[model samples]
Target: MEISCHKIASGKASGPALVSKEPISFLGTVDPETGEVVDPKHQLFGKNVGGKVLIFPGGKGSTVGSYVIYQLKKRGVAPAAMINIRSEPIVAVGAIISEIPLVDGVSAELLDLEDGTLITVDADSRRVRTEEG
Candidate 1:
């Protein structure tokens, strides 16, 4: 299904979804060099977000987390795109500076989608779709 949402960044990306049920604190939760979720307490621990469409509730923790996201992009390990139920300042700024496609105001149905489902996000168009559609 094609879902309408608010655009937080300007770009288009398609990839398998890496859904995270919890909010992410990028600075400590993700490894910039490898794109792995390093926080053992996180449900997504041990998973690599690289090249996927990272989906989560929103961002949490320090504003420095924004730079971490940028670092991931600079290191070529950032998610292809991102979707948030709500876009907070940190993640919003990160996606903007990193040029990663990002959208928020997504419906809860999106969070229920299984991991690895093909997802296409067109932030420029304020739309998201699943491969099944």
Candidate 2:
């Protein structure tokens, strides 16, 4: 199935998804070096986001989170792409500067996408699709 939405970054990626129902705070919650969610309180804590299509509601916490996302990319440990219900300044800026494929305003629920399922995101065209399609 193909779903079109707003493209926040111009790129494309195909990878397994790591879906989260909660917001992510990259600054203190994510390990820039390891790409692991380190905040124990976060539902995704202890999961490594590396190379996956990381999906979440949106971002929270400091704007410095943008730098953390960049750091992850620099360290070669960032998500292959990102999908959100909506895009905020912090996460949007991070995805832009990091060059991570990012799309928002998706109609499907993160849960419906299924964790670990391969999905393709084409941010340049503002579309996402399940591998089956």
Candidate 3:
């Protein structure tokens, strides 16, 4: 299925899907080493984000969130693309600095996407396409 939203960057990628109904907090919530969500209460907790399309409601906590995101990128533990219901400044800054594909203003239905689905994000055109694995 194809859905259009505002894209933070334009790109296509095929990777395992990771969906989170909760917003993520970069501070102390993610493990940069393994790209795993460390927050036990988070829907994606203990899930590896590496090489996956990371989808969440949005970001929360700390202006330094962007720095953490960049660090993850530098460590090669960053998600291939990001989809959010809304874009937070921290996430926006990180996506820009880390050069990761990002799309926001997406519908909550994105949360229904199963893990391992192949999805493409076109940030330039604000589109997201999903196909069966």
Q: Which pairs clash in the backbone of model 1?
A: none
Indicate the residue-level lDDT of 119 in model 3.
86
Candidate 1 contains a number of clashing pairs equal to 0
TM-score of each: 0.97, 0.95, 0.94
lDDT of 2 by residue, 1-133 (tens): 7888899988999999899988898998999999999999998889999999999989988999999999999999999999999879999999999999999999756556678888899999888988632
Clashing pairs in 3: 9-123, 10-123
- Model 1, 29-49: lDDT tens per residue? 999889999999998999998
Q: Indicate which candidate wins on TM-score.
A: 1
Across 1-133, the per-residue lDDT of candidate 3 in tens digits comes to 9998897766766577898888888878888777888988888888888889999989999988898889899999999999999989988888889989998988899998999899888787778899989
Give the candidates in order of lDDT, highest first: 1, 2, 3
Best by lDDT: 1
Please give the clash total of every predicted structure, in order. Answer: 0, 0, 2
Measured by TM-score, how close is model 1 to the native structure? Answer: 0.97
Assess candidate 3 and give its lDDT: 0.86
Quote the RMSD, in angstroms, for model 1: 1.1
Candidate 1 ranges beyond 4 A from true positions: none
In model 1, what lDDT does residue 120 have?
A: 96
| Cα misplacement distance, residue 90 of candidate 2 (Å) | 0.4
